[model samples]
Target: MGAMNTKVIEAEYDYVKPASLDEALDILAEKENVKIYAGGTDLLVKLKMGADLGMDIMMDINGIEDLYGVDKTADGGLRIGAAEKIWNLETNADVIAMYPILSEAMHLMASVSVRNMATIGGNFCNASPVADTVGPCMCYGACVELKSKKGVRTVDATEFFLKPGVTVMEADEILTAIILPAPEENTGAAFTKMARVRPDIAKVSISCVIKRDGDAIKDCRMAMGSVAPKPLFLGDISAELAGKKMSAALIEETAQKVHDFVKPIGDHGTTAEYRKEMAHLIAKEILEKAWENSGGELA
Candidate 1:
C-alpha cells in the first residue's frame, strides 16, 4: 500500500485587537507589515488569493469606540467613523436624509448580507476602481481623516486614491473617519450605474451634484467609477458645464466630453469601448436626475 502526501495549509500572522485609537496607532507605528482589518470583505479575499501584500500582522480596530459611530459635525457635515458598517450607513437617519445619493450607491452594492459586513472606510482603503461608494463620496466633497501616533492629517477624497488597490495612506496612518460637507441649499446629487446584474459590480457608474440658480446651472460636480484606474472626478468638464442652461443638446455635449476624456481599461467583464459608451450614458442620466432634483426641468 502506498500513502499519498498532501499539502497542509497553515495560517500565518498574528491578530491584535486594540482597545483605543492611541493603542492602535502605537501598534501601527511599531509593527512591520501591519495591515488594518475592519470588515475583511475585500482584504480577506485578497489574502486568500495570495496577493503579494507583504502583510504579517493584522490589526483589528473594531473595538475602538471612536471608530464606530456616524455623527454630525459642528459645521453640519457628517463624520462617519471608520469601522461603521455599511448597513448602518444605509439605514442611518441622518445619512438617508442628508446624503441619500451616498445611500443610493451603498444600497446598490453587493447584497444585504455583504453590506452588513462591509465598512465604508474599508471600501475606500481598498481603493477598488469600481468601488460604488467612492463616486458618491467624491460628488459630495468628502475628505478622509487619517491618524497615526505622530498626528492627524486630512486629505480630500478626490486626492485619496492613487490607483487600483492603492491609496495615499502611509503605512503608519489609519483611516479614522470620512467627513462629508453639508449639501448647499440649491444643490442636488444623484448616483446611477449600468451593471450586468443587480448584485454585480458596475460597468460604469456616475454620481452627479449640481446647483441651480433659476434656469441656469450655478455649479456642477460629477465623479465616475469603473472607467479609470481610480474613480474619475470630472472637475474640468464640470467647470465647463457651470452656468449653462440645462437642455438635451447640452447633455449630449457633456456626455460626449465624458466619453472623450475617460480611457477605461478592458477586462473579462467588459470591453473598453462598451465601458466608454456606458460612461456617457450613465453620466447623462445622473446629470438629468440631479438637475431635476435641483428644480430644473429637462429640455
Candidate 2:
C-alpha cells in the first residue's frame, strides 16, 4: 500500500525587496508566481490567516524610493505616491484642506496604528468589499497610475473594481500613484459612515461632492460603500439635481433615490434593508453638511 503526501504549504517560496519600480516589474515578469507586498498591513494579515499559502514568491516594493511622497500635479491636482501611509495623508494639512473627503475617509479607517502602517495603494489593492477609500476616491474622480515593464496606464477609481477583492491590475503591473483632480471652485465634499463603533469597519458609508452656481446646485457626485459588489455611484440621482435650487425637499428626494440605488446583501454586520435606509439618511446628512460648509451655496 502507498501513502499519499499530506503536508501543507505554509510560507512563500522566495522574497525580494526591490529598490526601484523597474527592478520590481522585471522580477514580477520573470517570476512564475509572485505577489507584491506594499504596506503589508492587509497582505501580511491575509498571509497569516492562510489566505495566500499558494503564493510562491513575495516582491516587497516598500523600498522603492520613487513611490513615497505627496506632490501636486501641474494641473493643480494632487498626486499621492502609492507608498504614502494612510496616517500621513490623514494628517497632512495640505491633503486635509484640499481633499477633505479623502482625509475624512482615512481618519475613519482602521485604528491609528494600522493607519500608520497602511498605504493608500495597499487599501485599494486589497479590494475589500467595503474599503473605506474606494467610495470617496470614486466620488472625487480619482485615477490610479499603474506601471509595468510594458509601460504605464491609468484607470479611473470608479472602474478599478471589477468585483469583491478584484481589480483591473494585471499580474505584471504595479500601482504607482493615485491622482485626484482639484475640487472645482464653489465645491465641497462630505463623507459619512455608519459603523457599530469607532475603528470598526463600516457597515455602510456614503460620500458626496457638490458644486454650486449661485444658489443652485451646479453639479453633484455621490458614491456608496458596503452596498454592492463594489462601491456604487449615484450618477442618475446626481444628474437629476443639477441646476436645481437646493432645498430640504430636493435633498430628501435625492436621498430617496440613493436609497433605491443600493442593492446591499445581508451580512453579519447589517441587514440589506438597514444598510439601504442608513445610506439614505447618511446621504442626506452629508449633503446638508457639505452645503453648509460651502456657505449655504454649493461649495
> Which digits, one per residue and each the tens of the lDDT, describe model 2 over residues 1-299?
12322253356468889878889989988876788777788877766656644678888888698788888888888999998999999998878888898899999898999998899999898888688887778877899999989999999998888888889999888899999997778887899889989788999998888888878888888888888987777778888888999998889888888888788999886899999889889988999987776666433
lDDT of 1 by residue, 138-234 (tens): 8889999999888999999999999998899999999999999977887888899888899998888999999899878999989999899998889
- Model 1 misplaced regions, further than 4 Å: 1-11
Candidate 2 has its poorest 10 consecutive residues by lDDT at: 1-10
* Clash pairs for candidate 2: 186-299, 187-299, 188-299
How far in Å is the alpha carbon of 18 misplaced in model 2?
Answer: 0.8
- Among these predictions, the greatest lDDT belongs to 1
RMSD of 2: 4.0
Q: TM-score for every candidate vs. truth?
A: 0.95, 0.93
| Whole-model lDDT, model 2 | 0.84
